[model samples]
Target: MEEKCLNIESKVVHGHSMFDPLTGAITTPIYQSATFRHPGLYETTGYDYSRLQNPTREELEKTIASLENGKHGFAFSSGMAAITTLIKLFNPGEHIILSDDLYGGTYRICEEIYKRYGLEFEYVDTSSIDNLKAAIKSNTKGAFIETPTNPMMKVTDIREASKICKESGVLLIIDNTFLTPYFQRPLELGADVVVHSATKYLGGHNDTLCGLAVVNNDELAEEIKLIHKSEGAVVSPFDCYLIIRGIKTLAVRLERHEENAKLVAEFLKNHESVDKIYYTGDTDNPYYDVMKKQSSGFGAMISFTVKKVETVEKVLKSVKLITFAESLGGVESLITYPVVQTHGAIPEEIRNAIGVTDKLLRLSVGIENVNDIISDLNQALI
Candidate 1:
């Protein structure tokens, strides 16, 4: 079913039923066998082995593809694995353009490993069309953007950037981990490929580590599928099952997350110890208009700065309800200091330039009562 044609809640509920009509089972079963039995030497039902392909994983892939409005979806061991596999499609010495503010792991992958293999990248302010235009080079093969970018929360104009890249014959890739398909559909906005760290929102509970890549182009999908098989980074059947189960509650969980986030953001904005709150729901936010145009919801992520590093430490240590944690997008609220937690890998100069400061804190609002979350922050700030 087309993403736009189906209700998101319905898609989440019935999109990936593993049991075919012949058996009529309620839940998808984990096909634990390593290899499927072939009828004859040359006969097959499109699956040969778990490593090459698994029935459980395929069902999950189909569900994700339907959700993201893409022709195909591939599951990987982790979000980085999905990214690495997609990048392998490009030849050595090919150039890539990326947003200046990105997940620290993405930055490290591009600078450390990709660079070592002759891949070149230029980091630019992709939130502006002019910056993207100026950054494009003859050798540029792909443009990667992270909207409401990590740590800084800078929203990129996906449609505008996709138009520019399409005209230049450059592949447009988006990291949709922050917003997820529940709030935003990058493919509908003209992105050629979308990637997510299923470890986050897609799996919701922070229990499983997985990644997914969805592509609209059939030819590109085949290439990625090939790389997935060759590289052997596919997610296991059990992880696939866990992710599929997690997705069933995505719609409801995201709604609660958004609601809680709005309340927490407002609380931080008025807090005496807070200096700034970076959230897309705030009309005064720099990327407010663009975010509104592209996403149905503003999402649950919030970044704010306290008075100083000392105060930051005090608040983190004092919080009772909100867990001081590294990863986000779980069922429980989490707090992180980006300068040392999420964006710590980036150099100090680069981190500061991208607005990842020592005083900055990120909150992943969970599906908990807003008062409990706020009360924890209140006591912590005091």
Candidate 2:
């Protein structure tokens, strides 16, 4: 054979290319110039401006598309920017349904910003296919979901949801942030589009901010591309370089993250202070089979409720090894209080109904030694 196919591990390590052809550099160089020069009249270099496209950013986009097994990829300045731009694909009167338990930022934008545009949003428990089917109407144009939803770890069946969406002429969009492509590929499982806060795992180090949308449909890809270029929320060439470097080690980092997370889940399960824990990897977890069927591995995020609501503040203030912070998917562990920090934008009533209460805490188990992480939690619980 002239060529051999590469596995996901190799595709990541050797993204798009092994070296830059122009300069023979190992890493893609940042094309920092905002505008490019032309050779002559009616003749133009492929890239005329950075706003439209940059060589570095283009490579990153292609890399992400390849990983997600999609036809096109668009990168934005941040995760929220990507979602906001994606909304432009629908008309003002188009209705969309979303998972009830999702990132507070997404909820805030749809309600506070996009509501006035005449787009109607229905919040439902998408973990159940019946709830999703019940919410669809004649005008329903799309369904957005976060599989193994934020804070709750509830898994949604992408294949089943895709079938329903296709039957109803609704486009299926999946926020694949938590599991990343290493663990789950939604498009491969039948999703029409996959979005990610690349800042989390694709950037890997929490050092860069990026949002990406990968689309399998040609028409959807073209529309998203138009909006991306016209709105100019594109990621910078330097940040693109950072994300490209981060993705190179994604396979190895995720392996360690999942290993530590499983151990942490076991520790919390037997702990006296914890009342209940949410882990996708748990054998008795209701959606464990769905995760097993759709994904290769359970992600590293874990959420649990404390016996006493007062313990929330104690743990938030007590952890020394694990930082009390907002963002996740970094090398260092982070403990988040969703009620106030991440999910505060969500209404209290909705928050309560979804189980993001004062007693609840979300943990992003990093690739640290399992013993150190558990010891920190053990002492913090005391």
Candidate 3:
């Protein structure tokens, strides 16, 4: 297929290259030196400083941009770094409405760090487009949403939300971390910007810590570039390499992850202890149709609330094969108690409003054998 016509699987696998210009290796080598030696004065190599840019990082950025169907991509040291840089794009007195139930770290920085700086944030159930439309005001400049939101797993209609934001002249930013480019490209769906906690799905393993951002327009791209350069949280060359290697198998990993998640979701649905199960692949999911419309696959992240809060720790400690961990979208089938581990930063009242109560458990279903995963969960729940 022509490069432009290539599907996501091919695009991610065969990300552009003659490999590295220095050695022409099949893999992009890490340009480890912090400073690049110039040929002379203003005449120079493509890179000047590692902080400004690096060849390995640039290659990763290009791949991410291409994957997201956007014009520019930036890699950050961590997800929070990318987000903090993004918040700088807004001035004080400007308001950005976000999904009520989102990653707690996002809530933390916005509340503790940026709120003090004058940025206004309003949390609402963005799954309801009416709620989003109602939240917009004269000062509202942006709407940030996480489809299939954290712990609760509520999905929003990205295209519809984009339309609403456009009518109001507001930017629509989607945190595409849970789904990643393999499954969904928000920029293609009319989002102004897309960001990811690449540590989760993009890295594909429990190893690397990284984040990514992509912009549809040059104006936003330029502003983000300036903030990224000024704030200096660019992903390191080695982490860039790790993420690249991980992307090479993203399509394959996600396929298996989804496969196992289907079985797992079904298992949970009939379980006595599972009070509520959240997985887009499940046909009964409230947003199942919306998820099917926008993305190719529903992904492996599943959050369920057990019948009793006391069962939370029992399940957490009982699982043998699955790990009790915080992060998601790795190759290991890890489980997390969102009330404490992930969404602890949000106040109890707010967390309870969104159903991220003490009873909820988030599962990052891995590409393990379906029977093994099910057997493990069965034992845990027992």
Q: Candidate 1, which segments miss by more than 4 Å at Cα?
A: 1-4, 17-19
Clashes of 2: 0
Question: How accurate locally, in lDDT, is each candidate?
Answer: 0.89, 0.92, 0.91
Cα error, candidate 1, residue 133 (Å): 0.9
TM-score of candidate 2 against the unseen true structure: 0.98
Backbone clashes in model 2, listed as residue pairs: none
Clashing pairs for model 3 are 148-155
- lDDT (tens digit, per residue) of candidate 1 on 1-382: 5455778788887765535544676577787878888989899988898889998899889899988888899999999999999788888889999899989998888888889989998999898899998888889999989997997898889999989998999999999998899889999999999999999998999899999999988899889988999889999999998999898889999999999999899999999999999999888899989988999998899999988678898998999889999888999999998888888779999988878888899999998899999999999997
The per-residue C-alpha lDDT of model 3 at residue 161 equals 97
Report the error of model 1 at residue 101, Å: 0.7
**Candidate 1: pairs in clash:** none
What local lDDT score does residue 69 receive in model 3, on the 0 to 100 scale? 84
lDDT by residue for model 2 (1-382), tens: 1112667888788777667878999888988989999999878888899999999998888888888888798899999999998777788899999999999999999999999999999999999999999999999999999998998998999999999999999989999999999999999988988999999988999899999999988888889988899999999999999999999999999999999999999999999999999999999789999999999999899999999998998998899999999989998899999999999999999999999998999999999899999999999998
lDDT measured at residue 333 in model 2 versus the true structure, 0 to 100: 93
Provide C-alpha RMSD values for all models, in order.
1.4, 1.2, 1.0
Which whole-number lDDT from 0 to 100 does residue 380 have in model 2? 96
Once fitted onto the true fold, the runs of candidate 3 whose alpha carbons sit more than 4 angstroms away are none
